[model samples]
Target: MAMAVGVVAAPLGLSVISLVNRLQDIFSRVGSHSSIDLPQVAVVGSQSNGKSSVLEALVGRDFLPRGNDICTRRSLVLQLVQIKPSQDEFGEFLHLPGRKFHDFS
Candidate 1:
């Protein structure tokens, strides 16, 4: 039944989440000072192809600039972290270390 499947999937999902958190911690400690080559995803398409829109939707935030004109001129590195519900949500930039951006806008 659906309930049995849900019980099995819940633990598997939690295990995956735990693994991701561990990997992120390891990368954070090792890659902060040195150049660590990590996996990347490139979204290539024609102009006005809704690429930015899709990324914003995936992140559940309207952080990307939107207008009729050209918005993004340089390459962007976006890092998304999953946090606990009790923890405060924020964003950080590699250039500006130790500063937490509470507002995405």
Candidate 2:
């Protein structure tokens, strides 16, 4: 991972510095970013409370399906995705472009 990062950063001189700065910014943004806040939700309840089910429903994905219990003990968060209706004549969903999801949210 370190080698891959270095390879990508070697091409753009100033851009690599900016990338590092952006990573720092993402970590610094606590209250203003929902991307940073969603992971903080604590799914606490009794046995068979459907906490994982609720999370899967909210995120519109199978966050905790069957046979995926090995890594369920930790508090790691899954990636969140957003889809919007197409504005063009032909009906098709358009992706929200760019990497700065914090700005979009």
Candidate 3:
């Protein structure tokens, strides 16, 4: 039997903690800039190339289904918003042009 060893490294002057904090800082302002028009981020990759995995790791959730088959046939839209002053948030359901998710449930 053979064994494999791997090493993890961060870019110069940036630790893993700082990277996580940076992600937090970015997401903290998700819904605050409606008029400034910041470009959206789109993840594109072939099947099993870590697209879903990257998003799941960032948000720390297993919500995305595997991309091995046609199970995920429809498009998914996620809207992240700060529900209140605290760290509370909500993201679910789809939004239409004329319709409104008043409940935000």
Tens digits of lDDT, candidate 2, 2-99: 46544554346455545554554456454344343322356876655677777768766553534434435545443332233553111111132342
Cα lDDT of model 1 by residue, 1-98, tens digit: 44754454446656665665556567766775436444456777888898888788877988877779889766776767667899888877666889
Model 2 is weakest, by summed lDDT over 10 consecutive residues, at 87-96
- My TM-score estimates for the predictions, one after another, are 0.55, 0.34, 0.40
CA RMSD, predictions in order: 6.7, 15.8, 14.2
For model 2, the superposed segments whose C-alpha errors exceed 4 Å read 1-25, 28-40, 67-71, 83-105
Candidate whose TM-score is highest: 1
User: Candidate 1: deviation at residue 74, Å?
Assistant: 1.4
Q: List lDDT for all candidates, in order.
A: 0.71, 0.46, 0.52
Roughly what TM-score does model 2 have, to 2 decimal places?
0.34
Cα shift from native, residue 102, model 1 (Å): 1.9
Rank by lDDT, descending?
1, 3, 2
